[model samples]
Target chain A: MKLKAPECVFSSAGFCPGCGHGLASRLVGETAEELNIVEKLVTVVDVACCSFNIDYWNFDTIMAAHGRDIPTAVGVKHVRPGCPVLAYMGDGAAYSIGMAETIHAALRNDPVTVIVINNSVFGMTGGQMAPTTLPGERTATSPKGKDPARYGTLSGVELLKGMDIAYLARAELVGVGGMAKAKRYIKKALEHQLNGDGFSLVELLSPCPTNLNLPPVKAKQFVHEEMTKYFPLGEFIDKGGDK
Target chain B: MSKVKLNIARCKGCGYCVDECPKQAISFTGRISEKGYDTIQVDDEKCIACGSCYRVCPDSVFEILV
Candidate 1:
Protein backbone atom coordinates (compact mmCIF):
# COMPACT_ATOMS: atom_id res chain seq x y z
CA MET A 1 0.00 0.00 0.00
CA LYS A 2 1.12 3.48 -0.72
CA LEU A 3 1.68 5.71 2.26
CA LYS A 4 -0.11 9.05 2.30
CA ALA A 5 2.29 11.88 1.66
CA PRO A 6 2.37 14.67 4.18
CA GLU A 7 0.27 17.59 2.96
CA CYS A 8 2.93 20.27 2.96
CA VAL A 9 1.28 23.31 1.42
CA PHE A 10 4.47 24.72 -0.03
CA SER A 11 5.64 23.01 -3.19
CA SER A 12 9.27 23.90 -2.51
CA ALA A 13 11.42 25.55 0.11
CA GLY A 14 14.22 28.06 -0.53
CA PHE A 15 16.83 25.99 1.32
CA CYS A 16 19.96 25.01 -0.58
CA PRO A 17 20.55 21.67 -2.24
CA GLY A 18 20.82 18.70 0.18
CA CYS A 19 20.08 20.87 3.18
CA GLY A 20 18.60 18.84 6.05
CA HIS A 21 16.59 21.81 7.33
CA GLY A 22 14.07 21.19 4.56
CA LEU A 23 13.62 17.59 5.61
CA ALA A 24 13.41 18.53 9.27
CA SER A 25 10.81 21.18 8.47
CA ARG A 26 8.84 18.66 6.43
CA LEU A 27 8.92 16.13 9.27
CA VAL A 28 7.56 18.71 11.68
CA GLY A 29 4.84 19.57 9.17
CA GLU A 30 4.07 15.86 8.81
CA THR A 31 3.83 15.48 12.56
CA ALA A 32 1.47 18.43 12.78
CA GLU A 33 -0.60 16.96 9.99
CA GLU A 34 -0.69 13.51 11.60
CA LEU A 35 -1.80 14.98 14.89
CA ASN A 36 -4.39 17.20 13.15
CA ILE A 37 -2.87 20.25 14.76
CA VAL A 38 -1.87 22.09 11.60
CA GLU A 39 -4.66 24.55 12.07
CA LYS A 40 -3.91 25.32 15.71
CA LEU A 41 -0.12 25.18 15.74
CA VAL A 42 1.88 28.37 16.19
CA THR A 43 5.58 28.60 15.37
CA VAL A 44 8.28 30.97 16.63
CA VAL A 45 11.31 30.86 14.33
CA ASP A 46 14.72 32.30 15.16
CA VAL A 47 16.65 34.52 12.77
CA ALA A 48 18.94 31.87 11.38
CA CYS A 49 18.67 29.17 8.77
CA CYS A 50 15.41 28.17 10.44
CA SER A 51 13.81 31.51 9.67
CA PHE A 52 13.62 30.53 6.03
CA ASN A 53 11.02 27.91 6.94
CA ILE A 54 8.33 30.50 7.50
CA ASP A 55 7.51 30.26 3.83
CA TYR A 56 7.73 26.47 3.68
CA TRP A 57 5.31 25.65 6.48
CA ASN A 58 1.70 26.78 6.30
CA PHE A 59 1.09 27.81 9.87
CA ASP A 60 0.91 30.91 12.01
CA THR A 61 4.57 31.81 12.36
CA ILE A 62 6.40 34.62 14.16
CA MET A 63 10.00 35.56 13.54
CA ALA A 64 12.19 36.10 16.60
CA ALA A 65 15.51 37.82 16.84
CA HIS A 66 18.70 35.78 17.14
CA GLY A 67 18.50 33.46 20.15
CA ARG A 68 15.16 34.88 21.33
CA ASP A 69 12.85 32.24 19.88
CA ILE A 70 12.25 30.65 23.28
CA PRO A 71 11.03 33.86 24.86
CA THR A 72 8.88 34.70 21.86
CA ALA A 73 7.40 31.22 21.86
CA VAL A 74 6.75 31.45 25.56
CA GLY A 75 4.85 34.68 25.03
CA VAL A 76 2.86 33.21 22.16
CA LYS A 77 1.90 30.22 24.28
CA HIS A 78 0.70 32.53 27.02
CA VAL A 79 -1.56 34.55 24.69
CA ARG A 80 -2.74 31.51 22.73
CA PRO A 81 -2.82 29.06 25.59
CA GLY A 82 -5.19 26.70 23.80
CA CYS A 83 -2.93 26.20 20.81
CA PRO A 84 0.34 24.27 20.58
CA VAL A 85 3.46 26.43 20.14
CA LEU A 86 6.76 25.37 18.63
CA ALA A 87 10.08 27.24 18.58
CA TYR A 88 12.35 26.25 15.70
CA MET A 89 16.01 27.31 15.88
CA GLY A 90 19.43 26.43 14.58
CA ASP A 91 22.47 25.55 16.74
CA GLY A 92 23.85 29.08 16.38
CA ALA A 93 20.62 30.56 17.66
CA ALA A 94 19.71 27.91 20.21
CA TYR A 95 22.99 26.64 21.61
CA SER A 96 25.16 29.73 21.40
CA ILE A 97 23.23 33.03 21.49
CA GLY A 98 20.04 31.64 23.03
CA MET A 99 21.55 29.22 25.51
CA ALA A 100 20.27 31.11 28.54
CA GLU A 101 16.72 31.33 27.18
CA THR A 102 16.62 27.63 26.34
CA ILE A 103 17.93 26.69 29.80
CA HIS A 104 15.42 28.89 31.60
CA ALA A 105 12.52 27.52 29.57
CA ALA A 106 13.50 23.94 30.38
CA LEU A 107 13.93 24.84 34.03
CA ARG A 108 10.61 26.69 34.28
CA ASN A 109 8.84 23.88 32.42
CA ASP A 110 7.34 26.26 29.87
CA PRO A 111 4.68 24.48 27.85
CA VAL A 112 6.39 24.79 24.44
CA THR A 113 8.06 22.43 22.05
CA VAL A 114 11.62 23.39 21.03
CA ILE A 115 13.28 21.87 17.98
CA VAL A 116 16.99 22.57 17.50
CA ILE A 117 18.69 21.74 14.22
CA ASN A 118 22.22 21.02 15.41
CA ASN A 119 24.08 21.06 12.11
CA SER A 120 27.33 22.01 14.00
CA VAL A 121 28.03 24.95 11.71
CA PHE A 122 26.42 28.34 11.13
CA GLY A 123 25.09 27.38 7.75
CA MET A 124 23.40 30.68 6.88
CA THR A 125 26.47 32.83 7.53
CA GLY A 126 28.88 30.85 5.35
CA GLY A 127 29.65 27.84 7.55
CA GLN A 128 31.11 29.50 10.60
CA MET A 129 31.95 27.38 13.63
CA ALA A 130 29.08 27.03 16.09
CA PRO A 131 28.99 26.09 19.75
CA THR A 132 27.93 22.59 18.78
CA THR A 133 30.78 22.22 16.30
CA LEU A 134 32.52 18.90 16.84
CA PRO A 135 36.03 18.82 18.20
CA GLY A 136 38.66 18.63 15.42
CA GLU A 137 36.03 19.43 12.78
CA ARG A 138 37.05 22.17 10.37
CA THR A 139 34.73 25.00 9.36
CA ALA A 140 34.95 28.55 8.00
CA THR A 141 35.86 29.92 11.43
CA SER A 142 37.72 26.82 12.59
CA PRO A 143 39.80 26.31 9.48
CA LYS A 144 42.33 24.29 11.51
CA GLY A 145 39.53 22.27 13.12
CA LYS A 146 38.03 22.84 16.55
CA ASP A 147 40.57 22.33 19.29
CA PRO A 148 38.84 21.06 22.41
CA ALA A 149 41.90 21.90 24.44
CA ARG A 150 41.27 25.58 23.82
CA TYR A 151 37.50 25.78 23.40
CA GLY A 152 35.23 22.97 24.61
CA THR A 153 32.39 21.65 22.47
CA LEU A 154 29.07 22.36 24.10
CA SER A 155 26.26 19.81 24.23
CA GLY A 156 23.06 21.88 24.58
CA VAL A 157 20.77 18.99 25.54
CA GLU A 158 23.26 17.82 28.16
CA LEU A 159 22.64 21.06 30.04
CA LEU A 160 19.20 19.75 31.01
CA LYS A 161 20.61 16.61 32.61
CA GLY A 162 19.45 17.45 36.16
CA MET A 163 16.72 19.88 35.22
CA ASP A 164 12.98 19.21 35.26
CA ILE A 165 12.19 18.85 31.59
CA ALA A 166 9.10 17.21 30.16
CA TYR A 167 10.78 15.52 27.21
CA LEU A 168 14.31 15.66 25.77
CA ALA A 169 15.78 13.60 22.96
CA ARG A 170 18.39 13.84 20.19
CA ALA A 171 18.08 12.28 16.75
CA GLU A 172 19.94 12.60 13.47
CA LEU A 173 18.69 12.73 9.86
CA VAL A 174 21.08 10.54 7.92
CA GLY A 175 19.68 7.25 6.60
CA VAL A 176 16.16 5.87 6.55
CA GLY A 177 16.35 4.61 10.13
CA GLY A 178 17.70 7.90 11.44
CA MET A 179 14.99 9.85 9.63
CA ALA A 180 12.31 7.57 11.04
CA LYS A 181 13.65 8.01 14.58
CA ALA A 182 13.78 11.78 14.10
CA LYS A 183 10.12 11.82 13.04
CA ARG A 184 9.10 9.89 16.13
CA TYR A 185 11.05 12.20 18.45
CA ILE A 186 9.60 15.30 16.79
CA LYS A 187 6.04 13.98 17.02
CA LYS A 188 6.51 13.05 20.66
CA ALA A 189 7.83 16.49 21.53
CA LEU A 190 4.78 18.11 19.94
CA GLU A 191 2.46 15.65 21.63
CA HIS A 192 3.93 16.53 25.01
CA GLN A 193 3.02 20.16 24.47
CA LEU A 194 -0.54 19.32 23.37
CA ASN A 195 -0.94 17.22 26.49
CA GLY A 196 0.02 20.20 28.66
CA ASP A 197 3.39 18.72 29.57
CA GLY A 198 6.18 21.11 30.44
CA PHE A 199 8.93 22.32 28.11
CA SER A 200 9.91 19.66 25.57
CA LEU A 201 12.92 19.71 23.26
CA VAL A 202 14.09 17.50 20.39
CA GLU A 203 17.56 18.21 19.04
CA LEU A 204 18.07 16.98 15.47
CA LEU A 205 21.62 16.44 14.20
CA SER A 206 21.06 17.71 10.66
CA PRO A 207 23.63 17.86 7.87
CA CYS A 208 24.96 20.87 5.93
CA PRO A 209 26.65 19.45 2.88
CA THR A 210 27.24 22.75 1.12
CA ASN A 211 28.60 24.40 4.24
CA LEU A 212 30.49 21.26 5.28
CA ASN A 213 32.25 21.29 1.89
CA LEU A 214 31.34 17.67 1.20
CA PRO A 215 29.08 15.95 -1.28
CA PRO A 216 25.54 15.40 -0.05
CA VAL A 217 25.99 11.64 0.14
CA LYS A 218 29.25 11.86 2.07
CA ALA A 219 27.73 14.49 4.35
CA LYS A 220 25.10 12.02 5.50
CA GLN A 221 27.84 9.47 6.19
CA PHE A 222 29.82 12.05 8.16
CA VAL A 223 26.79 12.62 10.36
CA HIS A 224 26.54 8.92 11.14
CA GLU A 225 30.27 8.31 11.58
CA GLU A 226 31.94 11.46 12.90
CA MET A 227 29.13 13.60 14.37
CA THR A 228 27.59 10.80 16.45
CA LYS A 229 30.90 10.32 18.25
CA TYR A 230 30.58 13.75 19.84
CA PHE A 231 26.79 13.95 20.16
CA PRO A 232 25.17 10.63 20.97
CA LEU A 233 21.53 10.10 19.99
CA GLY A 234 18.73 8.92 22.34
CA GLU A 235 16.17 10.11 24.82
CA PHE A 236 17.75 11.91 27.75
CA ILE A 237 14.58 12.62 29.77
CA ASP A 238 10.84 11.90 29.56
CA LYS A 239 8.69 12.94 32.48
CA GLY A 240 5.61 14.00 30.56
CA GLY A 241 2.68 11.78 29.61
CA ASP A 242 2.92 8.01 29.53
CA LYS A 243 4.94 6.73 26.61
CA MET B 1 4.93 -3.98 -10.07
CA SER B 2 4.94 -0.72 -8.18
CA LYS B 3 5.64 2.48 -10.11
CA VAL B 4 7.98 5.27 -9.08
CA LYS B 5 7.63 8.82 -10.36
CA LEU B 6 10.08 11.71 -10.11
CA ASN B 7 9.26 15.38 -10.22
CA ILE B 8 12.19 16.20 -12.43
CA ALA B 9 11.64 19.91 -12.14
CA ARG B 10 11.78 19.85 -8.35
CA CYS B 11 14.76 17.57 -7.77
CA LYS B 12 18.07 19.01 -6.56
CA GLY B 13 20.11 15.86 -7.37
CA CYS B 14 21.52 15.48 -3.87
CA GLY B 15 21.48 11.64 -4.29
CA TYR B 16 19.85 10.95 -0.92
CA CYS B 17 17.37 8.72 -2.68
CA VAL B 18 20.15 7.00 -4.61
CA ASP B 19 22.05 6.27 -1.39
CA GLU B 20 19.02 5.11 0.60
CA CYS B 21 17.32 2.94 -2.03
CA PRO B 22 17.49 -0.61 -0.71
CA LYS B 23 17.19 -2.16 -4.19
CA GLN B 24 19.71 0.14 -5.88
CA ALA B 25 16.89 1.11 -8.21
CA ILE B 26 17.48 4.88 -8.36
CA SER B 27 20.13 6.78 -10.35
CA PHE B 28 20.79 10.29 -11.57
CA THR B 29 20.06 10.95 -15.20
CA GLY B 30 22.68 12.84 -17.20
CA ARG B 31 19.89 15.22 -18.18
CA ILE B 32 19.76 18.36 -16.07
CA SER B 33 16.63 19.52 -14.33
CA GLU B 34 15.19 22.99 -14.91
CA LYS B 35 16.90 23.91 -11.69
CA GLY B 36 20.21 23.02 -13.38
CA TYR B 37 20.88 19.94 -11.27
CA ASP B 38 21.07 16.32 -12.48
CA THR B 39 17.71 14.67 -11.88
CA ILE B 40 17.20 11.10 -10.69
CA GLN B 41 15.57 8.33 -12.67
CA VAL B 42 14.14 5.19 -11.11
CA ASP B 43 14.47 1.70 -12.57
CA ASP B 44 10.91 0.53 -12.21
CA GLU B 45 11.77 -3.17 -12.58
CA LYS B 46 14.18 -2.94 -9.70
CA CYS B 47 12.01 -0.68 -7.58
CA ILE B 48 9.88 -2.32 -4.91
CA ALA B 49 8.14 0.93 -4.01
CA CYS B 50 9.56 0.55 -0.51
CA GLY B 51 9.20 4.35 -0.18
CA SER B 52 12.73 4.86 1.09
CA CYS B 53 13.13 7.56 -1.52
CA TYR B 54 9.84 9.12 -0.56
CA ARG B 55 10.90 9.19 3.06
CA VAL B 56 14.42 10.54 2.65
CA CYS B 57 13.92 13.06 -0.14
CA PRO B 58 14.21 16.56 1.28
CA ASP B 59 12.72 18.09 -1.86
CA SER B 60 9.54 15.97 -1.98
CA VAL B 61 10.46 14.91 -5.49
CA PHE B 62 9.21 11.32 -5.53
CA GLU B 63 5.78 9.73 -5.75
CA ILE B 64 5.36 5.96 -5.38
CA LEU B 65 2.38 4.32 -7.00
CA VAL B 66 1.46 0.97 -5.48
Candidate 2:
Protein backbone atom coordinates (compact mmCIF):
# COMPACT_ATOMS: atom_id res chain seq x y z
CA MET A 1 0.00 0.00 0.00
CA LYS A 2 1.27 3.44 -0.93
CA LEU A 3 1.07 5.93 1.94
CA LYS A 4 0.88 9.60 1.12
CA ALA A 5 3.37 11.87 2.81
CA PRO A 6 1.81 14.07 5.46
CA GLU A 7 1.60 17.55 4.04
CA CYS A 8 0.92 18.92 7.50
CA VAL A 9 4.62 18.38 8.20
CA PHE A 10 5.73 20.73 5.47
CA SER A 11 9.34 21.28 6.56
CA SER A 12 11.91 18.80 7.79
CA ALA A 13 12.23 18.41 11.54
CA GLY A 14 15.43 19.35 13.45
CA PHE A 15 15.59 16.30 15.64
CA CYS A 16 18.74 14.20 16.05
CA PRO A 17 19.66 11.38 13.72
CA GLY A 18 17.21 8.47 14.12
CA CYS A 19 15.30 10.25 16.86
CA GLY A 20 11.69 9.02 17.10
CA HIS A 21 10.25 12.51 17.60
CA GLY A 22 10.13 13.03 13.85
CA LEU A 23 8.21 9.83 13.25
CA ALA A 24 5.87 10.48 16.17
CA SER A 25 5.20 14.03 15.00
CA ARG A 26 4.61 12.79 11.47
CA LEU A 27 2.08 10.24 12.68
CA VAL A 28 0.15 12.91 14.55
CA GLY A 29 0.21 15.20 11.56
CA GLU A 30 -0.94 12.45 9.25
CA THR A 31 -3.72 11.45 11.60
CA ALA A 32 -4.94 15.01 11.95
CA GLU A 33 -4.97 15.33 8.17
CA GLU A 34 -6.74 12.01 7.69
CA LEU A 35 -9.46 12.96 10.16
CA ASN A 36 -9.95 16.32 8.46
CA ILE A 37 -9.23 18.06 11.75
CA VAL A 38 -6.19 19.95 10.61
CA GLU A 39 -8.06 23.25 10.54
CA LYS A 40 -9.59 22.72 13.97
CA LEU A 41 -6.53 21.18 15.57
CA VAL A 42 -4.70 22.97 18.37
CA THR A 43 -1.44 21.50 19.60
CA VAL A 44 0.20 22.39 22.93
CA VAL A 45 3.86 21.38 23.01
CA ASP A 46 5.93 21.05 26.14
CA VAL A 47 9.45 22.46 26.49
CA ALA A 48 11.42 19.53 25.23
CA CYS A 49 12.84 18.24 22.00
CA CYS A 50 9.27 17.49 20.95
CA SER A 51 8.50 21.20 21.15
CA PHE A 52 10.68 21.74 18.10
CA ASN A 53 7.81 20.20 16.14
CA ILE A 54 6.10 23.58 16.27
CA ASP A 55 8.37 24.55 13.40
CA TYR A 56 7.13 21.67 11.22
CA TRP A 57 3.43 21.23 12.03
CA ASN A 58 1.06 23.47 10.14
CA PHE A 59 -1.52 23.91 12.88
CA ASP A 60 -2.36 26.29 15.70
CA THR A 61 0.58 25.39 17.94
CA ILE A 62 1.36 26.65 21.43
CA MET A 63 4.56 26.13 23.37
CA ALA A 64 4.03 25.42 27.03
CA ALA A 65 6.49 25.41 29.89
CA HIS A 66 8.09 22.16 30.93
CA GLY A 67 5.46 19.80 32.41
CA ARG A 68 2.69 22.38 31.86
CA ASP A 69 1.53 21.25 28.44
CA ILE A 70 -1.49 19.31 29.74
CA PRO A 71 -2.89 22.29 31.59
CA THR A 72 -2.28 24.51 28.61
CA ALA A 73 -4.04 22.02 26.41
CA VAL A 74 -6.96 21.98 28.85
CA GLY A 75 -7.19 25.75 28.59
CA VAL A 76 -7.17 25.59 24.81
CA LYS A 77 -9.88 22.93 24.79
CA HIS A 78 -11.97 25.05 27.09
CA VAL A 79 -11.70 28.09 24.84
CA ARG A 80 -12.14 26.09 21.65
CA PRO A 81 -14.31 23.17 22.61
CA GLY A 82 -15.05 22.44 18.99
CA CYS A 83 -11.40 22.01 18.14
CA PRO A 84 -9.39 18.89 18.87
CA VAL A 85 -6.56 19.80 21.24
CA LEU A 86 -3.43 17.66 21.40
CA ALA A 87 -0.72 18.02 24.05
CA TYR A 88 2.66 16.77 22.87
CA MET A 89 5.30 16.18 25.54
CA GLY A 90 8.35 14.12 26.33
CA ASP A 91 8.76 11.58 29.12
CA GLY A 92 10.61 14.03 31.33
CA ALA A 93 7.99 16.71 30.93
CA ALA A 94 5.00 14.42 31.12
CA TYR A 95 6.01 11.84 33.69
CA SER A 96 8.41 13.73 35.91
CA ILE A 97 7.55 17.42 35.96
CA GLY A 98 3.89 17.33 34.90
CA MET A 99 2.89 14.07 36.48
CA ALA A 100 0.16 15.66 38.55
CA GLU A 101 -1.32 17.55 35.64
CA THR A 102 -1.32 14.43 33.52
CA ILE A 103 -3.10 12.39 36.19
CA HIS A 104 -5.67 15.04 37.01
CA ALA A 105 -6.52 15.56 33.37
CA ALA A 106 -7.16 11.87 33.02
CA LEU A 107 -9.13 11.78 36.25
CA ARG A 108 -11.40 14.59 35.07
CA ASN A 109 -11.64 13.01 31.63
CA ASP A 110 -10.44 16.16 29.91
CA PRO A 111 -11.24 16.11 26.20
CA VAL A 112 -7.67 16.27 24.91
CA THR A 113 -5.18 13.94 23.27
CA VAL A 114 -1.86 13.53 25.10
CA ILE A 115 1.03 12.24 23.03
CA VAL A 116 4.03 11.26 25.15
CA ILE A 117 7.28 10.39 23.41
CA ASN A 118 9.10 8.17 25.89
CA ASN A 119 12.73 7.94 24.90
CA SER A 120 13.82 7.20 28.52
CA VAL A 121 16.11 10.26 28.65
CA PHE A 122 15.79 14.00 28.30
CA GLY A 123 16.93 14.53 24.74
CA MET A 124 17.01 18.31 24.81
CA THR A 125 18.98 18.60 28.06
CA GLY A 126 21.76 16.29 27.00
CA GLY A 127 20.28 12.93 27.98
CA GLN A 128 19.54 13.34 31.63
CA MET A 129 17.80 10.53 33.44
CA ALA A 130 14.02 10.73 33.03
CA PRO A 131 11.22 9.21 35.09
CA THR A 132 10.58 6.68 32.35
CA THR A 133 14.21 5.64 32.08
CA LEU A 134 14.48 1.89 32.31
CA PRO A 135 16.29 0.24 35.15
CA GLY A 136 19.97 -0.36 34.42
CA GLU A 137 19.85 2.08 31.53
CA ARG A 138 22.82 4.42 31.45
CA THR A 139 22.26 8.12 30.92
CA ALA A 140 24.34 11.23 31.38
CA THR A 141 22.80 11.73 34.80
CA SER A 142 23.32 8.11 35.53
CA PRO A 143 26.69 7.40 34.01
CA LYS A 144 26.93 4.22 36.04
CA GLY A 145 23.55 2.98 34.81
CA LYS A 146 20.16 3.64 36.40
CA ASP A 147 19.75 2.35 39.91
CA PRO A 148 16.30 0.89 40.40
CA ALA A 149 16.60 1.31 44.14
CA ARG A 150 17.14 5.08 43.99
CA TYR A 151 15.91 6.15 40.58
CA GLY A 152 12.97 3.92 39.91
CA THR A 153 11.05 3.80 36.63
CA LEU A 154 7.38 4.64 36.45
CA SER A 155 4.72 3.56 34.00
CA GLY A 156 2.35 6.40 33.06
CA VAL A 157 -0.24 4.07 31.59
CA GLU A 158 -0.17 1.89 34.66
CA LEU A 159 -0.73 4.92 36.83
CA LEU A 160 -4.06 5.54 35.08
CA LYS A 161 -5.00 1.91 34.74
CA GLY A 162 -8.38 1.99 36.51
CA MET A 163 -9.34 5.42 35.28
CA ASP A 164 -12.17 6.07 32.84
CA ILE A 165 -9.89 7.21 30.05
CA ALA A 166 -11.31 7.23 26.55
CA TYR A 167 -8.13 5.67 25.22
CA LEU A 168 -4.67 4.71 26.48
CA ALA A 169 -2.02 2.91 24.48
CA ARG A 170 1.75 2.53 24.05
CA ALA A 171 3.62 1.55 20.92
CA GLU A 172 7.26 1.45 19.78
CA LEU A 173 8.54 3.15 16.63
CA VAL A 174 11.47 0.86 16.00
CA GLY A 175 10.49 -1.14 12.88
CA VAL A 176 7.89 -0.80 10.16
CA GLY A 177 5.42 -3.08 11.94
CA GLY A 178 5.89 -1.15 15.16
CA MET A 179 5.60 2.14 13.33
CA ALA A 180 2.28 1.01 11.81
CA LYS A 181 1.04 0.07 15.29
CA ALA A 182 2.11 3.42 16.72
CA LYS A 183 0.25 5.19 13.94
CA ARG A 184 -2.94 3.28 14.80
CA TYR A 185 -2.63 4.22 18.47
CA ILE A 186 -2.05 7.86 17.62
CA LYS A 187 -5.05 7.97 15.25
CA LYS A 188 -7.25 6.29 17.84
CA ALA A 189 -6.23 8.78 20.49
CA LEU A 190 -7.11 11.70 18.25
CA GLU A 191 -10.36 10.06 17.18
CA HIS A 192 -11.41 9.93 20.83
CA GLN A 193 -10.92 13.70 21.14
CA LEU A 194 -12.73 14.42 17.86
CA ASN A 195 -15.58 12.26 19.10
CA GLY A 196 -15.55 14.18 22.40
CA ASP A 197 -15.00 10.93 24.25
CA GLY A 198 -12.81 12.54 26.91
CA PHE A 199 -9.14 11.98 27.80
CA SER A 200 -6.75 9.95 25.62
CA LEU A 201 -3.03 9.25 25.86
CA VAL A 202 -0.73 7.48 23.41
CA GLU A 203 2.74 6.89 24.78
CA LEU A 204 5.27 6.01 22.08
CA LEU A 205 8.55 4.27 22.86
CA SER A 206 11.14 6.05 20.75
CA PRO A 207 14.91 6.01 20.43
CA CYS A 208 17.38 8.75 21.29
CA PRO A 209 20.42 7.61 19.39
CA THR A 210 22.61 10.53 20.33
CA ASN A 211 21.64 10.31 23.97
CA LEU A 212 21.83 6.54 24.03
CA ASN A 213 25.47 6.80 22.92
CA LEU A 214 24.83 4.35 20.13
CA PRO A 215 24.59 4.55 16.40
CA PRO A 216 21.13 5.07 14.93
CA VAL A 217 20.78 1.44 13.92
CA LYS A 218 21.86 0.18 17.35
CA ALA A 219 19.55 2.66 19.08
CA LYS A 220 16.59 1.34 17.14
CA GLN A 221 17.65 -2.10 18.17
CA PHE A 222 17.85 -0.94 21.77
CA VAL A 223 14.28 0.30 21.63
CA HIS A 224 13.07 -2.99 20.21
CA GLU A 225 15.08 -5.15 22.56
CA GLU A 226 15.80 -3.35 25.84
CA MET A 227 13.20 -0.56 26.02
CA THR A 228 10.23 -2.71 25.02
CA LYS A 229 11.21 -5.25 27.64
CA TYR A 230 10.30 -2.70 30.30
CA PHE A 231 7.65 -0.68 28.48
CA PRO A 232 5.56 -3.25 26.65
CA LEU A 233 3.67 -2.20 23.54
CA GLY A 234 -0.15 -2.60 23.20
CA GLU A 235 -3.39 -0.88 24.03
CA PHE A 236 -3.87 -0.61 27.75
CA ILE A 237 -7.35 0.95 27.41
CA ASP A 238 -9.62 1.76 24.48
CA LYS A 239 -13.10 2.96 25.24
CA GLY A 240 -13.72 4.13 21.72
CA GLY A 241 -16.54 3.59 19.20
CA ASP A 242 -15.36 0.13 18.19
CA LYS A 243 -15.59 -1.10 21.72
CA MET B 1 7.10 -2.76 -9.58
CA SER B 2 7.38 -0.28 -6.73
CA LYS B 3 10.64 1.66 -6.45
CA VAL B 4 12.53 3.51 -3.73
CA LYS B 5 14.11 6.92 -3.99
CA LEU B 6 16.38 8.68 -1.48
CA ASN B 7 17.13 12.31 -0.88
CA ILE B 8 20.70 11.63 0.15
CA ALA B 9 21.37 15.15 1.34
CA ARG B 10 18.61 14.99 3.94
CA CYS B 11 19.83 11.66 5.21
CA LYS B 12 21.36 11.65 8.74
CA GLY B 13 23.14 8.33 8.15
CA CYS B 14 20.83 6.65 10.65
CA GLY B 15 20.74 3.39 8.70
CA TYR B 16 17.17 2.80 9.88
CA CYS B 17 16.20 2.03 6.30
CA VAL B 18 19.03 -0.45 6.11
CA ASP B 19 17.91 -2.28 9.25
CA GLU B 20 14.23 -2.22 8.33
CA CYS B 21 14.68 -3.33 4.73
CA PRO B 22 13.55 -6.95 4.56
CA LYS B 23 15.36 -7.53 1.29
CA GLN B 24 18.70 -6.12 2.56
CA ALA B 25 18.63 -3.77 -0.41
CA ILE B 26 19.87 -0.60 1.35
CA SER B 27 23.50 0.02 2.31
CA PHE B 28 25.72 2.99 2.98
CA THR B 29 27.69 4.18 -0.09
CA GLY B 30 30.79 4.98 2.10
CA ARG B 31 30.60 8.48 0.65
CA ILE B 32 29.69 11.40 2.94
CA SER B 33 27.30 14.10 1.88
CA GLU B 34 27.75 17.83 2.37
CA LYS B 35 25.88 17.40 5.66
CA GLY B 36 28.78 15.21 6.90
CA TYR B 37 26.75 11.99 6.97
CA ASP B 38 27.25 8.78 5.02
CA THR B 39 24.80 8.43 2.16
CA ILE B 40 22.82 5.27 1.46
CA GLN B 41 22.48 3.43 -1.83
CA VAL B 42 19.59 1.12 -2.77
CA ASP B 43 20.10 -2.13 -4.63
CA ASP B 44 17.17 -1.97 -7.01
CA GLU B 45 17.39 -5.61 -7.96
CA LYS B 46 16.84 -6.70 -4.38
CA CYS B 47 14.31 -4.09 -3.30
CA ILE B 48 10.60 -4.91 -3.22
CA ALA B 49 9.27 -1.39 -2.55
CA CYS B 50 7.82 -2.57 0.74
CA GLY B 51 8.14 1.04 1.99
CA SER B 52 9.57 -0.23 5.22
CA CYS B 53 12.37 2.34 4.95
CA TYR B 54 9.91 5.11 4.20
CA ARG B 55 7.89 4.21 7.25
CA VAL B 56 10.72 3.96 9.78
CA CYS B 57 12.81 6.86 8.55
CA PRO B 58 12.62 9.92 10.79
CA ASP B 59 14.42 12.15 8.32
CA SER B 60 11.86 11.71 5.51
CA VAL B 61 14.74 10.67 3.30
CA PHE B 62 13.01 7.87 1.40
CA GLU B 63 10.22 8.02 -1.16
CA ILE B 64 8.53 4.83 -2.30
CA LEU B 65 6.90 5.26 -5.70
CA VAL B 66 4.39 2.63 -6.64
Top-scoring candidate (DockQ):
1
User: Which parts of model 2 have CA positions greater than 4 angstroms off?
Assistant: none
lDDT of 2: 0.88
**Model 1 TM-score relative to the real fold:** 0.97
Worst 10 residues of 2 chain A by lDDT: A1-10
lDDT tens readout by residue for model 2, A129-198: 8888899888998989999999778988889889998999999988888999999999999888888889
Model 1 lDDT tens row, B1-66: 548766777789999999999999999789987888988899988989888998888888877778
- Give the number of the best model, judged by TM-score: 1
Docking class of 1: medium
Instruction: DockQ each candidate and list the results.
Output: 0.72, 0.70
- Candidate 2, residue A58: the lDDT equals 94
DockQ of 1: 0.72
